[model samples]
Target: MKVLLLVAALVVVGGGIGLVLVMKSAAGPEKQATKVETGDCVQLTGAGKEADAVKAACDNPQTPYVVSVKGTVKGDCPEGFYSYSVATPLRGEGVGLCLGINAQVGLCFDDIKTKTPPPLVNCSGARLKISEVFDKASYVNSPCKEGTEEVISYTAYGATQKFKSATICFVKP
Candidate 1:
């Protein structure tokens, strides 16, 4: 009985130590951020769900391109029309889409010839909040020399509240 107890104790202790190590390893250093360069004429048109906005941009019907998501607004994404669109010059040509307020933020890439909708890569900070509208929120996905993700920051109505900040990410597709 004593021997069995000893074995059980050993197992318990070993498990505890393993758990601690795992938790510590999981808590690695914070990732460096990508600075997003705002305002380059990425726009979303029509009205529809946020997803629709993404789809329209992906199905641009105008050019052959790959769309990388920059940012999005969820509140205004319409249900039957293209709500938003943002174009980028990465991977040939990249476009973004949004619906405003609750719309999610992420990356989108499309191949024009086949009109395929590739999976969107949701970067670390891909959330929208009411604060976003007043304070300005943005998506930052610039590549770093080290290959790590870049840090993107958004500032809405810095001092005066005349105009709100533009949607950081999302344009059309």
Candidate 2:
């Protein structure tokens, strides 16, 4: 009788462990605060032209910018792309990333000209609204819709890597 009870208890505990493991796996990998994603938000630290980029949860009110493009070797970021360095900029050890205030359509920005990536704001104060997004960049002629008033493009260049770029279309709200 004692042996049977012990075996039963072990089976129950094993089943519970298996269930927990399954649940954990279904939830997917945990996101690190400093990790990079195409449309995830990040926080910038320091002052003026010198600053550091750290991944921040989109839910955080402070994280106003999302990555529009990554891994750029070009000397400068394309128009409207906010340049960011993953490593210490003083030593030039990190690759560059281009960021945007909104990751997709239906988002708004107030002061894109004066602010890098700008701060995502309510529609009431927004001067521009994101209308479209494309994976290509720098069209000789604007390919956006007739109402589009702003076009921003960012591109990545490396000797061996394939080219990558993104374009965003915006209109006055």
Candidate 3:
């Protein structure tokens, strides 16, 4: 009986340890705060020139800006806030010009081809909403949001043949 009790206790302890490991794995890695870099992708928290901006994964569907140019901006970006340059300057020595990405979300392909793309806007009150965002391989399998009316996808071509490509999904309400 004593031997049986010892075996049972060992089994229980082993099971507990296994459970802890599984839970830790499921929680995922913690994200660390990092500085924005040139060619990095970012998302703005609010409207206006002084809005807070956060670095994001380039493929992140929520990301609206793609760092196009980074340097000590001379006077003002010729195009102004809506231009390639961000409305406000970034921290550190130089400013980063973030070109708007996925701005063609709501409009049809023909519309996109004819007209110039618009500036990035916050998610709320946007005519075009991102229902699901994924890479080229996973886009077809990704699910759409409940009220999504239309689905559209955009692909960003890289400069080099070896560059990895990304795809974004947008929905019109």
Candidate 4:
């Protein structure tokens, strides 16, 4: 419900573009990003299944997906989660990262379900506006925002049941 400022740095690598978010905070000093783990945010290179994911600043509007379970098999992402595989220079094989929507309050998104990482869009005429997000099994009632048309949420069982995260996403009314 307060103002948060995002600070990122752009780095060019061999004609490709990469962004690193150095600091992020809300009404306070900037917080540094030092590590990557589950529940962290990621920036995708494209909207396809093969899109590469790089750790980005959490709560960033540009970073559409949040890491739900890292180090899992590719294509093992639970419902609402996407699978992204990355190759490490040191390893012969690729690593898998499961991601879900990085839905933040007040941010708007378009093509939420149709795209791998839904495109971020202007709030005006946007398809969805995040009012609040809740981890599954943690909430008891709907908390959608007033005048909201829908509560975005889902649950599904995967092949191996690696890590199924069902988030109760809704707006606070």
Best by lDDT: 2
Taking every candidate in turn, the Cα RMSD to the unseen true structure, in Å, is 18.1, 11.1, 16.1, 16.2
> 2 or 3, which is superior by TM-score?
2
lDDT of 4 by residue, 8-122 (tens): 2222342243222221221122111113467677776633333356778776777766776777334576555566665432223445776677766776775555424566677
lDDT of 1 by residue, 12-59 (tens): 999999997776566432211111222212222233222122222323
lDDT for model 3, please.
Answer: 0.45
Winning model by TM-score: 4
The positional error of residue 49 in candidate 1, measured at the CA in angstroms, is 32
Write down the lDDT of every candidate, Cα atoms only: 0.31, 0.65, 0.45, 0.54
Which segments of candidate 2 are over 4 A away from where they belong?
1-52, 56-79, 83-98, 159-164
**Which tens-of-lDDT digit does each residue in 1-173 have in candidate 3?**
99999999999999999998787666433211124554566665544444444677765656655543344444332221223323333333334343434332432221222122244455555555544554442346445556655443333345642212334445653
Ranking by TM-score: 4, 2, 3, 1
* Candidate 3 vs. true structure, TM-score: 0.34
lDDT score of residue 121 within candidate 3: 52
